[model samples]
Target: MIKLTLLLLFFIIFIKKNICWSDEPHMIVSAIAYYNLNDKEKRILNKIFLNYKEDRDFNDPITGALWADHIKSNEHSTVNPSDIRRYEILDIFNEWHFVQIPYNPTKMFLPHYYLNAHKGKYNAMGVLKYIYKILIQVQKKPRHGTYFSYNFYLRFFIHIFADIHQPLHTISFYNEHFPNGDKGGSDITLNYHGQIGKLHHLCDNIFYSRKKHWPHINPSILQKEAHVLMNMYPPEHFGSKLTIPSNKIDFIDSIANESHQLAIEHIYSHIPVRLVNKDMQIKVDQHFVINLKGILNKQMVLAGYRLSLYLKDIIANIPEDL
Candidate 1:
């Protein structure tokens, strides 16, 4: 009995740890959006994601299956220095790559991390600053006659964009009181519609679940809500006491609206939402029930539009295609 109990406890701990480390669902959706492209667009996207897959070694059974097709066959073998040169190509997209890392969440709330080398309490930021410099070097290399791989960069761009948009990914709890150990807001607990849950899991997966679907709201409504919230709360409200009071219907409404907009724009629109019945049955007609396909269709249009904007700025300086 004692041995069995120990084994059960270990299993429980293992599950919790694994769940904690799972990739954010929104990132998954973004990756899928890139994967489902076709022709010229698909080729360009493939070149980018191929590099990301190799760098991250995304071969785990669950996540790997989603990205396995894009992993390079020669990635493990010897290759010329120029064969893996997209890191240099990233220079064309440097402005997007640069993100502010949040330290001292009490005073400032930013998300994302970079390598910094400075000493003392601020040393991490210094390391991030130095890393950014190195990244710039990689970006400046010539693309002369060099064929670029599309596999990793595609997924990397998609993943990084989604990661930055996540509020928790942008902020840190670095104060002595909170110790900055919330694992990107996953540590904080809250009653999400009466269910006991942690903020991290809530934002990452639970929020993506179809079982407890949140209502859909338009962007204008969300914009208004965000404006109101920005006016009502101080930045410090995002600190340790991150709670939505019972009386704050407006606040809750605003959050739900904003979350829904983010969902519509960044997530729901990018992939098909499969609906499953209580008996574990799949609903075919309702497969893309979230109305995400239309949303993704729009996002692809937006991505192409945005990509053109960057291409115009960067490609104009490059040799013209014959």
Candidate 2:
């Protein structure tokens, strides 16, 4: 029984890596965004994020970044559970991590690909917009504000904002071979040297430094990496796109689209269509790995910069009394 339990635990950790950006990048993005806030905004967030049900897990900005991901259950999932159940008190869902915009080759990368028809509003793009609206309304009417709800969605917004910036999270591969879509590269296996994993896992863990047991990893190392990424790819690196859209929906959609484009240019362009199946796996060479890391690093920095702006807007609007 003990051996079986330990095996189950290891399996969960292994599979979890394929699902979303590993904890290191998620926390690092939040750390970058956190420092971008002014003194007052920081103070407000520090207080607001102090406790969720008195759980100290989300009290600090960097540590708290993983809250949204943590709430999602390994078994049942919390995002949009059809039936109201005892365990799912939160709206956190495994689905909220990615928006599937199909990358169909026959279609010649048409504009229709960007439409939200795939998963409707259940995806990261739609949910982020929904939560932003709620947070805005809650700030306007602090008298009717639910503190827990506010904190809950705020954490989700922060996490999801960074999520959509990840290329694989915004788009999936769909060709004649995969009529159903690749589930954001999760279905497509890749062999990099001797390491074998899904394409999604490779993209999610491109940072690949001190990944295991990440929750207890040194906080300073995360902070230092965040600073290094920011210095490496400053806001000036991305012109005009960094401008937050006045329309919240447009902002969310725009970032999702940006990540989708990245999926096309960086991810899919490299792999041949013939080798997209389980039988014949995609063989990754050293050059591809190096270039992928560079692109992913840029994505991380971009996520952090854009997230900082979004956080500033959210923090600025919360009612002083709330």
Candidate 3:
């Protein structure tokens, strides 16, 4: 019920802060995920809406995907019982979307013990564990009178599935300038094509320049993109390479591992980070842009496809009691 209220007090804080991708990409991923749902999975999703149809948004996966971000808006912070404290308390939800896996192996890294001590903190990995537990509970016991609780978890899971795939979100590189962490490149500024911005925004703001190029997201387009990416790197690659994890921890951990590796090998790889006009900025060479675009496309496609599969498997495989 508290989560439902928190989510209901929506959109006041989110727009002011940075977002992972513009709504378009998130929508695209949701649409693609919807496309991948089997008929039985689709029916199970509709069942979650039995008591929630009036809420409406959760019934629609694309809009449902953005609900978590919407609730982060600031006005909710003021309206809640704790007033300002509500914002402070709710701020943790933002970090729940991104893991801060350390990138540098050579530097004086924060000990694993230090990090493990912080478990249940707002980092993406920890929050994911919490969220998954809540989801399993909601699935098993459900709320007495409302589907709102179930709806909230479903919506949040939809968004984070997309969020973790954005490599920068899962990575926190530590080095000389950023002795603590780069806060996913927000601390590092970059100059791309004469425009200067934080390195994180360079990745975050990779939006569609022309509508014609990106177009409105729909299942068809998402399906096409998903297939293209899957054909290049089949879903079986991950499933076949390792034992399919049985629990939520191992499941979410696999995705985080992929995200962090991408952060080191692709997002942070060989990019020149130096000062320009007294502010640090990363230099984007032509080849880097080419690769960056490719990686982003692949990540988006992969996120959508996997999110679909995850939801599908969960519903079809759940105990009949659920």
Candidate 4:
């Protein structure tokens, strides 16, 4: 009964759009990652997820990829009241989704107020490193206990891998106009197709869709999109970018820096600067939209490939008994 209720709640909430890549793109990323695995790797993944097949929250990688985001919903608080401590921990670390890496192209002087607001805080990069270690430990020793289950860590691993790939999530721009920062472009208002919207939200909904299939995803749509993306941008398409770093920490930092650099060169450079502080909005044009979509598309593909490669390594390290 509880699972049914949560499923209904997810459908209702997902009907509206989300602020980051929406659920569709996340699902597509998971699907792409799964499809990238070999036959044996797929079987191992299936075995690991067998315990969660019936659970609405993480029945599959596609659903699991959205678990991190779904927890933000009010309904999630009531799903498992028995785990108060766990819920509390999650609430405290709820802001782990993004890391505010500063970006100042002109190096204009500004107050030190917003520069290090997120410094020393637990961000996506930190969470990912911690979770990756937990995963390896759990696989090495089946009895390696944790505050959260292996599935919990696995789902978060999948979700954060995709989240950090978003350019806006890894960077925030600072300048003279808005001395502080734009809160990862959330404060930048723009006229998108005659509608006033935040720049961050617009970027988040790059692959936006209003199709509502309650309590379940349209598998055809998900698989087709994933397949198309893999074909369109294969691993070789990324060239040297596909080569991951040797150290895990370096690997995570590389991902964050890649997205941050892309935001500076591609995103901030193309968009018009908002001069007026009043009702003026940056009018979005086709050229800008096209360019933004292209960058986002490649990011999504690269994230999926990286996710698949990481999972493959994890599975290889796991003991057969696990």
lDDT of every model, 2 decimals:
0.31, 0.72, 0.61, 0.69
Better of 1 and 4 by lDDT: 4
Q: Candidate 1 overall Cα lDDT vs. reference?
A: 0.31
Estimate, for each residue in 53-130, the C-alpha lDDT of model 2 and write its tens digit.
646466777767777766655443332334422232444487788888877776533355454454577889888988
lDDT by residue (106-132, candidate 3, tens digit) is 455576743553244576667656656
Residue-pair clashes per candidate, as listed? 34, 3, 11, 0
Off by over 4 Å in 3: 1-17, 47-59, 74-92, 109-121, 137-145, 205-243, 272-278, 317-322
lDDT order of candidates, best first? 2, 4, 3, 1
TM-score of each: 0.36, 0.84, 0.72, 0.80
For candidate 1, the TM-score is 0.36
Which has the higher TM-score value, candidate number 2 or candidate number 4? 2
Residue 103 of model 3: what lDDT?
68
Off by over 4 Å in 1: 1-24, 27-39, 47-100, 103-153, 174-176, 206-322
Residues 183-240 of candidate 1: C-alpha lDDT, one tens digit per residue: 4444444332233444444343333331111112232443343334334443353353
